[model samples]
Target: MATAGGGNAHMVFRRYLDAVGLQGLASAEAAGLHTSEWYALSLITLEGSLSSGELASRTGLTTGATTRLIDRLERAGYARRAADPHDRRRVI
Candidate 1:
Protein backbone atom coordinates (compact mmCIF):
# COMPACT_ATOMS: atom_id res chain seq x y z
CA MET A 1 0.00 0.00 0.00
CA ALA A 2 2.97 2.30 0.30
CA THR A 3 3.94 4.18 -2.84
CA ALA A 4 7.36 5.47 -3.87
CA GLY A 5 7.42 8.07 -1.07
CA GLY A 6 5.53 6.65 1.91
CA GLY A 7 2.18 7.11 0.20
CA ASN A 8 -1.49 6.60 1.16
CA ALA A 9 -0.88 5.89 4.83
CA HIS A 10 -4.54 6.21 5.91
CA MET A 11 -5.87 4.05 3.10
CA VAL A 12 -3.10 1.55 3.66
CA PHE A 13 -3.90 1.20 7.34
CA ARG A 14 -7.60 0.90 6.65
CA ARG A 15 -7.00 -1.80 4.09
CA TYR A 16 -4.73 -3.66 6.47
CA LEU A 17 -7.40 -3.66 9.16
CA ASP A 18 -10.02 -4.83 6.66
CA ALA A 19 -7.86 -7.71 5.52
CA VAL A 20 -7.10 -8.75 9.07
CA GLY A 21 -10.79 -8.70 9.99
CA LEU A 22 -11.64 -10.84 6.97
CA GLN A 23 -8.90 -13.29 7.81
CA GLY A 24 -10.16 -13.58 11.37
CA LEU A 25 -13.65 -14.34 10.09
CA ALA A 26 -12.35 -16.95 7.67
CA SER A 27 -10.20 -18.63 10.29
CA ALA A 28 -13.04 -18.68 12.79
CA GLU A 29 -15.38 -20.18 10.20
CA ALA A 30 -12.84 -22.86 9.43
CA ALA A 31 -12.74 -23.76 13.11
CA GLY A 32 -16.55 -23.84 13.36
CA LEU A 33 -16.58 -20.78 15.61
CA HIS A 34 -18.54 -17.58 15.41
CA THR A 35 -16.43 -14.45 14.95
CA SER A 36 -17.44 -13.18 18.39
CA GLU A 37 -16.58 -16.51 19.94
CA TRP A 38 -13.22 -16.49 18.28
CA TYR A 39 -12.49 -12.99 19.56
CA ALA A 40 -13.62 -13.77 23.09
CA LEU A 41 -11.56 -16.94 23.09
CA SER A 42 -8.56 -14.99 21.99
CA LEU A 43 -9.09 -12.51 24.82
CA ILE A 44 -9.55 -15.25 27.39
CA THR A 45 -6.50 -17.07 26.14
CA LEU A 46 -4.47 -13.92 26.39
CA GLU A 47 -5.69 -13.11 29.89
CA GLY A 48 -5.63 -16.72 31.12
CA SER A 49 -8.92 -15.98 32.94
CA LEU A 50 -11.36 -13.15 33.51
CA SER A 51 -14.84 -12.67 34.85
CA SER A 52 -18.01 -12.87 32.77
CA GLY A 53 -18.67 -9.16 33.23
CA GLU A 54 -15.18 -8.35 32.07
CA LEU A 55 -15.69 -10.43 28.99
CA ALA A 56 -18.91 -8.60 28.29
CA SER A 57 -17.25 -5.23 28.74
CA ARG A 58 -14.22 -6.08 26.66
CA THR A 59 -16.28 -7.56 23.86
CA GLY A 60 -18.85 -4.74 23.91
CA LEU A 61 -21.57 -7.33 24.33
CA THR A 62 -24.52 -6.92 26.63
CA THR A 63 -24.43 -9.15 29.71
CA GLY A 64 -27.05 -11.46 28.27
CA ALA A 65 -25.21 -11.85 25.00
CA THR A 66 -21.98 -12.58 26.79
CA THR A 67 -23.66 -15.25 28.86
CA ARG A 68 -25.07 -16.84 25.74
CA LEU A 69 -21.66 -16.69 24.12
CA ILE A 70 -20.15 -18.51 27.07
CA ASP A 71 -22.89 -21.09 26.97
CA ARG A 72 -22.14 -21.81 23.35
CA LEU A 73 -18.44 -22.07 24.00
CA GLU A 74 -19.07 -24.41 26.87
CA ARG A 75 -21.31 -26.62 24.71
CA ALA A 76 -18.58 -26.69 22.07
CA GLY A 77 -16.04 -27.77 24.72
CA TYR A 78 -14.07 -24.60 24.26
CA ALA A 79 -14.74 -22.74 27.51
CA ARG A 80 -15.84 -23.34 31.06
CA ARG A 81 -16.92 -21.23 33.97
CA ALA A 82 -15.06 -21.30 37.24
CA ALA A 83 -15.47 -19.60 40.57
CA ASP A 84 -13.32 -16.55 41.18
CA PRO A 85 -12.15 -17.96 44.52
CA HIS A 86 -11.66 -14.44 45.72
CA ASP A 87 -15.24 -13.49 45.08
CA ARG A 88 -17.88 -16.13 45.58
CA ARG A 89 -20.45 -14.09 43.71
CA ARG A 90 -18.27 -13.72 40.63
CA VAL A 91 -18.02 -16.21 37.79
CA ILE A 92 -14.85 -16.39 35.81
Candidate 2:
Protein backbone atom coordinates (compact mmCIF):
# COMPACT_ATOMS: atom_id res chain seq x y z
CA MET A 1 0.00 0.00 0.00
CA ALA A 2 1.04 3.59 -0.58
CA THR A 3 1.73 5.83 2.35
CA ALA A 4 -0.11 9.09 2.95
CA GLY A 5 2.54 10.92 0.95
CA GLY A 6 1.61 8.83 -2.15
CA GLY A 7 4.69 6.73 -2.05
CA ASN A 8 4.85 3.03 -1.24
CA ALA A 9 7.07 2.66 1.78
CA HIS A 10 8.67 -0.58 0.65
CA MET A 11 9.42 0.73 -2.85
CA VAL A 12 10.76 3.98 -1.51
CA PHE A 13 12.95 2.17 0.98
CA ARG A 14 14.20 -0.20 -1.69
CA ARG A 15 15.15 2.71 -3.95
CA TYR A 16 16.92 4.49 -1.15
CA LEU A 17 18.75 1.29 -0.26
CA ASP A 18 19.67 0.65 -3.89
CA ALA A 19 20.93 4.19 -4.33
CA VAL A 20 23.07 3.82 -1.24
CA GLY A 21 24.37 0.51 -2.49
CA LEU A 22 25.25 2.03 -5.87
CA GLN A 23 27.03 4.88 -4.18
CA GLY A 24 28.90 2.40 -2.04
CA LEU A 25 29.90 0.42 -5.11
CA ALA A 26 31.22 3.54 -6.82
CA SER A 27 33.07 4.61 -3.71
CA ALA A 28 34.48 1.13 -3.31
CA GLU A 29 35.77 1.14 -6.87
CA ALA A 30 37.43 4.48 -6.32
CA ALA A 31 38.98 3.25 -3.09
CA GLY A 32 40.02 -0.12 -4.48
CA LEU A 33 37.94 -2.05 -1.96
CA HIS A 34 35.33 -4.75 -2.44
CA THR A 35 31.77 -3.52 -2.03
CA SER A 36 31.26 -5.44 1.23
CA GLU A 37 34.58 -4.21 2.51
CA TRP A 38 33.59 -0.69 1.66
CA TYR A 39 30.44 -1.05 3.72
CA ALA A 40 32.50 -2.24 6.67
CA LEU A 41 34.92 0.60 6.14
CA SER A 42 32.05 3.06 6.14
CA LEU A 43 30.83 1.72 9.48
CA ILE A 44 34.31 1.87 10.94
CA THR A 45 34.86 5.40 9.70
CA LEU A 46 31.48 6.54 10.98
CA GLU A 47 32.31 5.38 14.51
CA GLY A 48 36.06 5.99 14.44
CA SER A 49 36.59 2.32 15.29
CA LEU A 50 34.85 -0.72 16.70
CA SER A 51 35.75 -4.11 18.07
CA SER A 52 35.84 -7.08 15.73
CA GLY A 53 32.84 -8.61 17.49
CA GLU A 54 30.93 -5.39 17.09
CA LEU A 55 31.88 -5.21 13.46
CA ALA A 56 30.84 -8.79 12.93
CA SER A 57 27.50 -8.14 14.57
CA ARG A 58 26.94 -5.01 12.56
CA THR A 59 27.92 -6.64 9.29
CA GLY A 60 25.89 -9.78 10.03
CA LEU A 61 28.91 -11.96 9.53
CA THR A 62 30.44 -14.64 11.71
CA THR A 63 33.24 -13.46 13.98
CA GLY A 64 35.70 -15.64 12.12
CA ALA A 65 34.61 -14.15 8.82
CA THR A 66 34.89 -10.69 10.25
CA THR A 67 38.41 -11.51 11.38
CA ARG A 68 39.23 -12.58 7.87
CA LEU A 69 37.73 -9.40 6.50
CA ILE A 70 39.80 -7.39 8.91
CA ASP A 71 42.89 -9.27 7.90
CA ARG A 72 42.29 -8.43 4.25
CA LEU A 73 41.62 -4.82 5.06
CA GLU A 74 44.74 -4.67 7.16
CA ARG A 75 46.87 -6.20 4.44
CA ALA A 76 45.50 -3.67 2.00
CA GLY A 77 46.58 -0.91 4.44
CA TYR A 78 43.02 0.30 4.76
CA ALA A 79 42.72 -0.57 8.47
CA ARG A 80 44.74 -1.73 11.40
CA ARG A 81 43.91 -3.26 14.74
CA ALA A 82 45.34 -1.98 17.95
CA ALA A 83 44.89 -3.13 21.50
CA ASP A 84 42.43 -0.92 23.30
CA PRO A 85 44.26 1.25 25.77
CA HIS A 86 41.96 0.51 28.65
CA ASP A 87 41.63 -3.17 27.84
CA ARG A 88 44.52 -5.17 26.51
CA ARG A 89 42.38 -8.13 25.49
CA ARG A 90 40.36 -6.01 23.07
CA VAL A 91 41.35 -4.89 19.59
CA ILE A 92 40.29 -1.45 18.45
**How would you encode candidate 1's per-residue C-alpha lDDT over 16-91 as one tens digit per residue?**
9999999999989998999999999999999988888899999999999999999999999999999989988988
TM-score against native, each model: 0.85, 0.79
- Over 1-92, each residue of candidate 2 has an lDDT whose tens digit, in order, gives 44556457777888999998898889999988887799899899898879999999999989998999999899999999999998999888
Q: What is the overall TM-score of model 1 with all chains considered together? A: 0.85
Best by lDDT: 1
Clash count of each predicted structure: 0, 0
Model 2 spans > 4 angstroms off: 1-16
For candidate 2, the lDDT comes to: 0.89
